[model samples]
Target chain A: MKKLYSTKYFKNKNNKHAEASLKKRLRFKKNKKKRNKIQNARTKPQKRVVNNKNKHFDYFKSKAPGNFSFLTHPIEVIEFISTLKSHFDKKRKVFILMNKIKSIDYSAIVILLSIMVKFKEKKVEFNGDFPSDDNINNILIASGFFQTLFKISFKTRERYNIGTHNAIHTHAWKDVDAELGANIMDNVSKMILGHKVIYKGLQRSLVELMQNSFNHATPTKEGEKHWWLSVNVNEKQKIASFSFIDYGVGIFESLNSKKEGSKFFNWKILMNLFSSENNADVLRKILNGDLHKTVTGKHYRGKGLPGIKEAMDRNLISNLHIITNNVFANVGLDKYELLPNNFEGTFVYFEINAQTSSTPWTELQ
Target chain B: MDRITVKIARDFSRTPGPRYIKEGKWSGEQFRTEKFYSIFDDAIKNDKIVVVDLDGTLGYGTSFLEEIFGGLIREHHLDYNQILNHLELISNEEPYLMTDIFAYLKDAHEESLVDNH
Candidate 1:
C-alpha cells in the first residue's frame, strides 16, 4: 500500500512538470510569431501612391532636356529614351522628370506614351512629374498624357480647356483596327475641313502603318504589337500634324526577321548590306523600291511604303519625316542622316493642310 | 451576259482590313473567301462581267487589295488575264487604286509562272 501510494504521487508530479513546460513553449512560439510579423513589415516594399502632390520615391531619375522634342532635339530625346529603356530592362523603378523641360511637342509625347505603356505592360514601376512651367504642364495635360496615365476620360481635357492647345490628343491600338482608323480619319476630316470628307490618302497611310505594326512589329503572333498615333490641329492655320509610332523590329530589322509561317528565308544578304551602310542610304533605297523586290522576292509586296511616298509626292500630305532604326529623314527636304544614337523603332510624322486634297463624301448607295 | 456588281462598302465592309482574317475583322482574305470568291466563280462560269465599286469605303491597304485581287490568281488558281478580262474596277474616290490593282495582278501572275517553272 505504501509503495503504490508513493508511485502514484510521483506520476502526478511528473505530469504537472510536463504541463508547465508545454505552457512555456507556447509562450515562446507566440513571441516568435509576433517578432516575425514585425520583421516582415520592415522588409516589404511600399506601394506607390499617384497623387497630385507627387510623393517622392527612392527612384532613379530619367531627366529630360530643356526642349523635350524629337523634331528639334532628336539626339537628346533618343538618347534619353534609350537610357530609359535600359533602366526598364533592369526592372529599376524610375521617376521621369520633365521639370526642366521648357518646350515639348506631340511627337515626343507620343513616343513617351508608347514607352510608358510598354513599361506598364512589363510591370516596371515608373512615375512621371509634369514640368514646373504652367504652360508646359497644361500642354502635357492637354496632350492627353495625364489622362492616359491617370485613367481619366475626356472630362479631364474639358477641365483643362484642351482646345486652347493644338494637340487634339494621343491614342494607341494593339492590332490592325480598321474601324478605329476610319473613325480617326472622319474626325480629322471634320476637324480640318469642318465637314466629314473621306481623306483617302491619310486613311490609307494610317491603315498601312497599323497593318505594318500588326505584321512586323514583333516576332510574336499577330495582334501582339502596338502602335501609337497623335494628332495636333491648328484650326486657324488650317494645318493638322499626325504622328505615328511603333516600337518594334523597325523597318530595316523587320525585313530580316523571319515572319510567322513564311516559307522564305531571312534576308541575310540584305541584312549584311543594311549593317554596312549609313542606314540613310538604305532608307533611301527602301523608299525608292529597290530593296523590296530583292528582299521580299514578291513584286506584289512592298507597295505600302512606296504608296505613302507617292501620297507625299502628290501633295496629299506634306512635311513628312520618317525616323526608323538609326536614320532620320526629312523626306520633303530629301535629307536623310544617320543618328549618333539608334532608335529601335519607327516614328513617322506628317501634316495635311488646306493645300491637301480630299475625297468628297458621297451618300451611301 | 449579266453585269454582276459588288459594292465593297455596302456588301463587305466600309473599313476593309489587312491581308488575312487572322489579322483582324473584315480582312481581305475574309472578303475573298466569303464575298468575292463566289462572285468571281459565278462570273467565270456564266460569262458575266464583275464590276467592283471601290468608292464609299474609307480606303484600301495595299495588302488588302493584293490579298483580294492578287489572291484570286495566287490562291484560287484563276488566270490573271482571265480574271482581268472579267473584272472592272470603279474607284472614283482614289483612281490611283486602280493602277495599284493592275500592278498586283501582273505581279501575282508573274509569281505563279515562277512557281510553275
Candidate 2:
C-alpha cells in the first residue's frame, strides 16, 4: 500500500528544488539593490575644500573699496576684512560691505564700528555705502558711529538721480562708494585690538535690552524672532548713534500680561517698575542704602538698566533719549523730560561725544 | 548645664544658585529655601554644635541675609559667644565678621537699653 500510494517522489523533489531556487533569486535581487545603493553613495562627489579655499582667496583679491558683496555669514565678512587690511597700504580708502547684509547683532555692529573708529583715528580716508532706505540709514546714524565719522547730507533732486545709482559719489573730497568687495584688512586689524573691551560693555547693555525684548515684549516662538540694528558716524559733529528696532510684541503687551489690576496699566506704574525697589532683594538693598547694587535673580535681576545708567553717567553724554509706545523720555544735562511721539516700539538714542578723543577702551581699566 | 546650640536657618552645603543647577537636577527656588530653612531649624533645635559657614553660600544680597539671620538671632536670643564661635568656624575675615557681629550686638544692646527704660 505504501509503495503504490502516489508514485511521484521525483516530481515532489523537483517542486521543492524549484521553490528553494525562487527564494534564492529573491534574496539575491534584494542584496543587489542594497549593493547598488552603497555604490551610488560611494561615487557621490563631496564639495572640495580646496575649491572653497581658492574661492575665499579670490574673493578678497576681487573686492573693491566701498562696495558690498553677497556675504551671509559674519565670519566670512570678518575674514574678508582681515584679508583687505593685510593687502591694502591705505587703510582710509576702505569701506564696509553692508548692502547685502540681512541681519546684524550688537556684537557685530560694535566690532564694525570699532574698526571704523580706528581707521578715523589713524587719519585714514574711510567712507561707507549704507542702504539708502531711511530706516536703515537712521539705524546706522543711531549706532553712534554715523555721526562720528561720515558727513551726511541729503542729495538734491538733480544730484540724487545721479548719486543714488552710482557706485561712488563724491562730496567735498569725501567719496562715498558702493558696496564693492573692498580691502577692509586695515580696519579689521585695528578693530581686533580694540573691539574686545569696547564691545563688552556695549554688548552687555544691548543684550540686556534685547533680552528684555525677547523675554518680556515681543515673545518670539522658537524660530520667529526678527530684529534690526544700524550704526552711523557723523564726521562734522563727531557724534555716533546706535539704534535697534524690533517688530515683535511691544512693552505695553508684556506689562499688560503680568498686570493684576486696572491701575497697573498706567504709564506711571510702568515707569516705577523700570525704576523701583519693589522686589524683596531690591527693597532690602534700598533699605540697606545700597542703591548702586543691582538686584538679580531667576525671575528678574538685571543690572542692565542700572549698568546703562552708570555707563551714560561715566561717559557724560549730554543727550539720552528713550522712546517706547509713543512716549519719549529725554535725559539731558539740566533735567529729565518726556514727550509724545507717533512712533511705536522702543528706541534708545544717545549722542556719543566723538570730540572727547577717547574710545571706550581708553576708559576701561 | 550650658548647651551651645546653633540653629542654622539654611544648609550651606545644599543651597545652590540658579547658575549652578542643571535642568535635570532643577530644584525650584522654593524647594531650595525650604531645604535651607529646615536644616537650620533642625540644627537650632538640636543642642549640638551649630556651625554657620557662609564661605561660598551667600548668594543673596547682604540685606536678605541680614533680614533672615537677624530675625533668627533675635527669636532665639543667641549670645555673642555663640555668634562669634559660629563665625570663627566659618571665616576669619574682619569686615564681614565685624559687620555681622556689630549688627547683632547693636540690636541686643538697644533692646537692653529699652528694657532698662
Candidate 3:
C-alpha cells in the first residue's frame, strides 16, 4: 500500500517538471526567430521594387545635376544624363522625380521630353513630375512641351494639313527620308516662318543632320540613337530658331573611334594631337571638310557638315552655332571656343531671319 | 543614238527616301543607285545618250546623288568629265539639282585622286 502511494506522487511531480521544460524550449525558439528576422531586416538591401511594381527614384541620389538652358550650363545636361543612366541600371519601373530640379530652361524641356521618348521606346514604364515652380511650368507649356508629349500634328489656323500642328515642339528622327523631312520643312516654312516655299537645301540639311546622328551618334542600342528638334518662331521679331540635340558619342570622340576603326593613325603619335588641339578646333576642321584628308580617308566623309554650312551660306539659315562635346563653333563669327565642361553629344541652334532672304516664301512652292 | 530615259518615279523608286542597302528597299544605297548605275553603264557602253528624269518622285539625298554621279568616278574609274559627257540630268521641279550633282562629281573627282586610302 505504501509503495503504490509514493509512485503516484512522483509521477505527478515529474509531469509538472516536463511541462515547464517544454515551454522553456518553445520560448527560446521564438526569441531566436525574432532576433534572426531583425538581423536580416537590418542587413538586407532595400527592395528596389514595391508591391505596385513601381520603383522610387530620387533625382539627387545619383549626385548628377540637372541643367537649365543647357547652352549656358552644358555640363549639367551631361550630368543629368549620368544620373538618369544610373537609375536606368536598376531596370525597374522608373518614376522620374523632376521636382528636385534646381534649375530649369526651355532647352532642358526638349531634352527631358527626348528622354521620355527613350523610355517609351524601350517599353520601360515611366512618368515624371513637373517643376513645382509655376513659371517653369508656364515656360515648358508655352514652348510646346505638352503638345509634343501628346504627339499633336503640326498645322495651324492656316493649313488643315494632317500631322501639321502649328507649335514649337519636340520631334525625333531615325532616317534621312523625304516624307518626314519635307513635312517638317513645310511646317517651318508656312506655319512658323510664314513662307510659302520649302527650302530644298535646308530640308536636305535636316536629313543630313539625321544622317550624322545615325552615322556618328553611336548609341548603346542602334535604334536608341535619337535627335531632338525644337523650332520656335518669334513672329514679332521676324525670326525663327531651331534647336537640335542628339545624345550620343560626340564628334571628336566619334572621329577618334572612326580613326581607330580604320587603323589610320598610331594612337601613340595621335595622343600628341589631342594635347595640341581641343575638340572645338577639330569641329572647325570637320565643318571645313579638312578632316577628310586626315582621318576618314573617304571623299564622301564630312559632307554633311559642309552641306549644312552651304544652307547657312545661301541665306537659307543664318547666325548658326553648334555646341558639341566641350567645343562651341559659331560659324557666323568664325569662332571656336572650348567650353568649361563637356557635353557628351551635340546641340545645334541657329536663327532664320525673314528679312535676310531675297527669296520670298510666297514665291516658293 | 538612243536617248534612254530612266523616270525615277516609274522605273526606279516612287518614294526613294531611305538608304538601306541590306533590306533591298528603294533607298539611295540600295535600289536607286544600283539600278541607275546599271542603266547608265549599259547606255555608255553602247555609246547611247542618257537622260535622268528627277520629277514625279520624292526629292533626292546628297548621298544618292553622290553615289550615282560621283560613284562613276570613285568606283568605276571614269573621269568626272566623261560621266558628264555621257549622262545628262534634267529636273524641271528642282532645276538646281543638275548643278549640284555636277559639283558633287567634281568634288569627288578631286578628292578621289588624292589616294588617301
The top-ranked prediction according to lDDT is 1
Q: Number of clashes in every candidate structure?
A: 0, 40, 8
The DockQ of each candidate is 0.38, 0.01, 0.14
Please report, as a residue range, the 10-residue window in candidate 1 chain A with the lowest summed lDDT: A154-163
- Please identify model 3 stretches exceeding 4 Å from their true place: A1-67, A90-106, A120-128, A132-135, A142-164, A192-195, A219-224, A259-274, A294-302, A356-365, B1-26, B31-35, B51-61, B73-82, B90-117
Tell me which of candidates 2 and 3 scores higher on TM-score: 3
Task: Give a tens-digit lDDT track for model 3, residues A1-365.
Answer: 56764797887987899999999999999999997786567522222222112333432233324446665666666667656655565554555554456666546766766765665455555555555566766666676554544453322121111112455555665544455555555666664456555455555566667667766788333434667777666667766667778888887766556544453345324434667776777677767766654544444332577767766776767877787888878887888888776777877777666644433332211
lDDT of 1 at A4: 64
Sort the predicted structures by DockQ, highest score first: 1, 3, 2
The lDDT ranking, best first, is 1, 3, 2
**Please, what are the lDDT tens digits per residue for candidate 2 over residues A165-202?**
11111111011111110112112213333231222223
| Candidate 1 Cα misplacement greater than 4 A, ranges | A1-54, A151-167, A258-276, A294-302
Off by over 4 Å in 2: A1-200, A219-225, A234-239, A248-253, A261-306, A316-318, A333-341, A351-365, B1-117
lDDT at position A304, candidate 1: 68
> What is the alpha-carbon lDDT for the whole of candidate 2?
0.37
Model 2 per-residue lDDT at A30 = 99
